[model samples]
Target: MNLLRERLTTPGDPGALRAEEGERPQSHARAYQSLKMQVHQLLLSRIDLEAMENLSDDHLREELGLMVERLLAEENLVVNASERRNLVRDIQHEMLGLGPLEPLLADASVSDILVNGPQQVYVERRGRLERTDVSFVDDDHLMKIIDKIVSRVGRRVDESCPMADARLPDGSRVNVIIPPLALDGPVMSIRRFAAVPLTMANLIDFHTLTAEMAEVLSALARAEVNLLISGGTGSGKTTLLNILSGYIDHAERIVTIEDAAELQLQQPHVVRLETRPPNIEGRGEITQRALVRNALRMRPDRIILGEVRGAEALDMLQAMNTGHEGSMTTIHANSPRDALSRLENMLAMGGMNLPTKVARHQISSAIGVIIQANRLTDGRRKITSIQEITGMEGDVITLQEIFSFRQTGVAEDGRVQGYFQASGVRPRFQERLRSRGIHVADHLFDPGRRME
Candidate 1:
């Protein structure tokens, strides 16, 4: 142990690691294993693990310092002054943070973190993105960080497998690419999750949704009105859909299908299923379409698809049109009209040769309401339009907007000032509600109503 401490603390024979013949560096696996085992045994021999548990914080830390010192000296790991400082840093990395960027990523206010390479790191704070000086020593360090992240999720990343998508324990999404695959270097992108998933009330407080809109949407959800929430990427469509699904009766069975399982519904009768990516051997791939088909057989009263982006849109539409009238799904689009068009396009991806008119008819009958959420230039997510599909007129599907947000202008503070106004187009679904003995507010279309 003393010899190891001396060797580690002393100046290493700088040339000892170099081979005589100019060949590849020999593996240090055997030496490293021996060093680790000797240090661990020395630590156990001197410190009573059970006794330390009764010590207070300060006392425990004091005892730990003594234990570490003994472990370091007895192992004979003589680290020179320069190496000693680095050893301290390595210990800090394991005990405290992921170098300097861990604290920044852990900050609740930080929305996104980007690592262009080993040295360049950027973060998105508030609505503005800024570059940070946080960096790693090199690609080796960066790859270690990537391994640390993926290892926690039972994922693997290495030379043979250069790319992986994983989530942290807190559900923060992580994507990593290494070596030749990443052109630049090891790259990582993390999208942090909300500490506590937001509810409808929380969205109202955040100004993401007006109270009146929340009330109407909640009522619509409870009334079993099949809804399609549309938005661009990061426009909070799934978040809003999650809160809307929260309105379903707790007694009814709910089945949710997701690609990555981001929804956090709290109902007791909810069943959540996530799609699986293909294994390295090109087997065991379970897609969202498969999950949607499986959910249909689960005897679910309501089926919720996290997003309809591919051929799965056909199954989602069929589910809603057949018997699951209370089902909900999301699509990527800029507006309600575009959402229907996007649905038609995705339905085409299913390889069905249905006529365009028949496709529109199927969509018009399947989707009852379209709530288009827009991320304004100011980074505020607002329900820009609420349109009801009033069936087809001849060969064209008729869409009537009941409520819309018209921007007056940008405020002095750069925030957008918009008013939720009624389009004066009476909801065609009003008669359907009346037929079902469901009464809606008479003044729902009145422009005088304050959405607040």
Candidate 2:
């Protein structure tokens, strides 16, 4: 008689013979027989926890593997090895990072991954794009994935804190939102960068910029000119800024401030600072403005802001005007003009009673150039405009188009082909260049020819 039947009847298998007679063939009689033998063998092979404590992890794993193999054999089960292996992997992956998305995250070609809840996943691959069939089981499963992501970065996420901004080990930017705040259940956005960060020469090889453009930007960097990179979201502003900042001499002391530090500038003397969000108790927040003000006292030769979004605009502009010549920052805008306007509006966010005209004048004086980037219809990123800040002409800040992208025509492959050409009018900065006894080459500003 089986122990289960005997236990149900009386203690110590009392009615053993009668129980054996009663237990006949049933619908799952074979399953029961198979399960009983495996359990008996498992109990025989069991090691005490105290004994296992002295075993190395590898030894324990090997013993567990042997146990599972013996169990499978005793059951006379012909398991599909690949599917069963995948099943175990999937379970572990779901407990960690939602199985399917993990592969894409590991892929170097993938720059961004968008998972619309659980059903849809899209990836930006190479210069082109495509979608993949990957999903989470449900909202709970998605939340687990988010927790896994943030936990690796030493961040927290819960109802009290339904949002988080963090970075993966590879410096991939991660943002997560959950529940009522998200409205569409849990959401995650990961912006990935190349393992070996792209340099100026790398960008040139990718057709993102010409060698001549790189040279000009390098010269601007060496000249300690304040540059404002303007672009819509994901136009590679920070990437360009990182490459540009590499041109700064390692001797100069550099300070960088960011909401989330993303810039990877390769310089010896660099101080990176990040803004802090309010704590769970709704206190102890260090804002970008505070960082910028504090950066001023650090005796930095140049200040590089990751991006200007709020009251920090006032401090940044003041810094640029007061002996910080090469201070750089980025802003979200469609064009150079809009970026300047956004700066003015963000200055107002400081809650100071400064007039719009005053802010415009400050921007016109502080900023030297605006480098505009745009994501084209064909998914190509190009520097569409480079406008020199020619100071304020009355109430309007004048911007002269130093270099512009004139679309020569579309290629046979449906990609737009264009080259950055200089406007006929020379830059006003030539006078400043002449003052430094550095001649501005006439051919550098020439039109209708490929200089690079």
Best by TM-score: 2
Please give the TM-score that candidate 1 achieves against the real structure. Answer: 0.78
Q: Which stretches of candidate 2 lie over 4 Å from their true place?
A: 1-81, 84-99, 127-129, 152-154, 408-413, 431-440, 450-452
Off by over 4 Å in 1: 1-101, 151-163, 178-181, 430-440, 449-452
How far off is residue 264 in model 2, in Å?
A: 1.1
Poorest lDDT segment (10 consecutive residues) of candidate 2: 1-10
- Scored by CA lDDT, what does every candidate get? 0.76, 0.75
Which lDDT tens digits does candidate 2 get at residues 1-452? 01111122222333211224355446443433333333333433443555556667556545544544544454444546763454434433432344567778778888888776866678887656677867665677577677877776556788888988877767778888877788877778888877888988887887777766677777788788899999988888988998899988899999999877788878989999977767778778889999999999999999999999998899999999999988898999999999988988988998877876788999999999999988876777778888999988778999999787777788888888777777777788777656755565777777767532
